[model samples]
Target: MANGLTVKQQRFVDFYIETGNATGAARKAGYKKPNPQGSENLAKPSIKAAIDARLKEIEDARVADAREVMIFLTSALRGELKEEVVVVEGEGEGVSSARTLQKQIGAHDRLDAAKQLAKRYGLDGDGELLKLQKEKLKAEVNEMKTAPSDALHINFTFDRRPKDGH
Candidate 1:
């Protein structure tokens, strides 16, 4: 046993992290009764700590930190990311030799990424610009609501008449 945990316990921790299923991990670890031992093992301090540490290690390796996120956002804003697009140079031909060319990402996507980066990095004029823009839009909407409708209005008044025309 390593670190005071049995071999099966270590295996269980490994499988648990991989499968994310306690009972399945226990079964894979060769536990006789996985149903009960699966959850019970997690309650053990050593196993829990080992699992937590391993998970942290995996996250540290697989997950990106704030700096990485910022870098990615910057790259997206700069349109450095590319997408595969099929361009047909010769129309009316069934299969034309088309070459994929690297082009800047669409303005819409780049603008979206830029907006997020701006908000995240305090580049939106300390939120004051956004707030003012929002206020301006709201005022425009209010003005539109109060503006006279150009829709044509028609009213018809009919006098009540008896069936006998009396």
Candidate 2:
């Protein structure tokens, strides 16, 4: 019925989509010889085309692409996303009531989003470079503090005789 496939063939495709196992899908679709039938069905051009079209449709409907992922990461970084957590009230006794509380997303989650955003724009290296520069500057300052002054020059003359004959 679907894509010119027979009813059993369409059922096989549907089961294949759900289970991702060809022989299992064939069995579920009531095939007596599931292993060979599954392989035979997969070898059909029309069935493969149908499966490809349906898979593409499913992916387009469900999977998040780059743009969607970027949007999510940006929203998470900006704190625009929120979630509701159910808090259960119970001390040492038994249990009381549960309350649903609305709050901003977790800090670690936001930080991870920020890190991912930074990595996308190649900003993750800035922190490392800045830290290295700070360390180098500190080492230079320490060296300057312990270094001898250039103005304090020392000259050695081994002449012990006076200018006029002693």
Candidate 3:
């Protein structure tokens, strides 16, 4: 009546003041549910007790943090870890034309795959198709030499495997 809080109410009020979370303080203070009457809810002393408990926990945590900061400051005063640090600033462009170059490079790789398939079909060493393939290979090599370094890597492995031991 004098203040909104009795001595007991003041304790709960103090808890909420410290923790800043009524629900958490309530659970911490071991409050399960309010009494059956709606009037016996958060407006009640029991609920305030729970809130007070949570506030204590928050205060304890803040105290711990303050202690850690003090320790760290003391250590720094004693002179530890003075290594030089370098931080690079970002230029902010992502993947600059990389995909375009990759596709161009991939085209050359596809050509090489076709060449392999041609050989497997026995078309490259005998038919008119074989003559066309040789011309294509020459053009590809010339194009590759002129292209940027990020362009495809072309590798050819010659057969050392013996003909089907017939």
Candidate 4:
């Protein structure tokens, strides 16, 4: 039994680690005792609970993997941005990564502006901050057309859902 799991749980775990499925793994782990009715007696709640927990672990692992990827990509982009990734108001999510250094980082005005706009709109949009960041990036690039590498500013905004759902 690996990881302090019971023999049965170990089998289920192994199958889960391989196939990432609880019900399927449990079935494969010998939950096939057929009754006189010719149906498998696989209605054990303990087995179901174990499978549910294993599935949750698998899902959590997947989420962690995606978060790592996001960190890596953000770091890479920050590195490319180099000294141009100025923080006019607040810290960025992944701005401090080593592989991707930034320049002219600060905080004050831009952050306040974003907060104000988001507050005004009640901050309800699903990805409003992301959209606002993209717009701010575009504006920063445009403003620095002549000295594009000199610096960049970023702002974030959020929107609230309309009252009537329009």
Candidate 5:
């Protein structure tokens, strides 16, 4: 009914949105036999438009802007978020005190998140992060090219001793 789609087409859209799999959505929407053309059905212009509109609506409803993502990463980097912990009680009287352990989000993860945020904000350079990286790599290559040739030269020799029997 919506977007000029038939009831089945609308159901297909709903299923596709919920399951995020075209073939599965087709099967769930009452396609009894093998539908090798299921993806092709989804590719129809009307169906595609309906799906895109639904996705846009969903994305708009769940609003997490780049600023929010950056703030969360900053908070994580600052250790402002509480770490999860688990406690286990021992069964025996002689057992040690109950053990407690905090969950760990590795430093590498935090650093990588921070780096992604930095790249998104263009803090690293004019272009995107990959472009900046390419530029940096080019600069390093140029530096290596211009460096003294003597630095590249290495002289070494191996000394072989005569055999004991000889």
Candidate 6:
């Protein structure tokens, strides 16, 4: 409404969030058929801003914020959580014992979680890693392009006879 979106435009926002696809959302919103540029139209500044506002509203209602995510990941990585198990013995004279088993997060799991946190906080050198990977891939592509065709060809002859003297 603030963006002056029409009824159909508002419906498009709802469908977009539901489908996570702009073209499909436009179709579901009862927009014109065969609208190949539906996504492009949605990319317009006003439309994009409306969508962003709607998404923020939905996220604020349903999703956890960054701090909550960090706390959860930190707890998981630290293995501070425990699993409760109840053991029962005998049916009539049942004896129940409740036990809490500490969940041990493996080194790999902790490393992965830490890496994710680092990435979220921009502490990981992801840009450098990406640059290195890009350079490596470019080098490989150049090598392939400059490689001699004969280098890829192999000739083999097999003398299957016992070794000249059985």
Winning model by lDDT:
2
Determine the C-alpha RMSD for candidate 6 after optimal superposition of all C-alphas.
11.1
Residue 35: error of model 4 in Å? Answer: 8.2
lDDT against the true structure, per candidate, is 0.88, 0.89, 0.54, 0.55, 0.77, 0.77
User: In angstroms, how far off is 142's CA in candidate 3?
Assistant: 99
What does candidate 1's lDDT look like per residue over 1-166, in tens digits?
6577899999999999999999999999999999999999999999999999999999999999999988988898888988777775865657566877767789898898898898896677768788888899999788777878874354798979987898
Give lDDT tens digits, candidate 3, residues 1-166. 4545455445445544656555554444445541332234356666555555666787887775745754544444444424343444555675222211111223444455455555555666565677788899999898988999998787898887789854
lDDT tens digits by residue: candidate 2, 1-166: 5369998999998999998899999999999999999999999999899899899999898999889999999999888999999998886668588899989998899999999988777578886687789999999778877878874454798988898968
Candidate 4's error at 108, in angstroms?
25
> Who is ahead in TM-score, 4 or 6?
6
RMSD of each: 13.6, 17.5, 27.7, 21.3, 10.8, 11.1
Candidate 2 minimal-lDDT segment of 10 residues: 145-154
Give candidate 2 regions above 4 Å deviation.
1-8, 19-39, 86-97, 126-166
State the lDDT of candidate 4 residue by residue for 122-153, as single tens digits.
57363577679889999867778856564655
For candidate 2, what is the TM-score?
Answer: 0.52
lDDT of 5 by residue, 40-137 (tens): 76779999999999999999779887778888888776656556666767778867555657655568767776777777767765546678789999
Number of backbone clashes in candidate 5: 0
- TM-score of predicted model 1? 0.58
Model 4: residues with Cα > 4 Å off, grouped in runs: 1-6, 16-42, 65-70, 80-166
Error of 4 at 103 (Å): 19
Candidate 4 TM-score versus the reference: 0.31
TM-score of each: 0.58, 0.52, 0.26, 0.31, 0.42, 0.40
- Backbone clashes per model, in order? 0, 0, 3, 4, 0, 0
lDDT of 6 at 132: 87
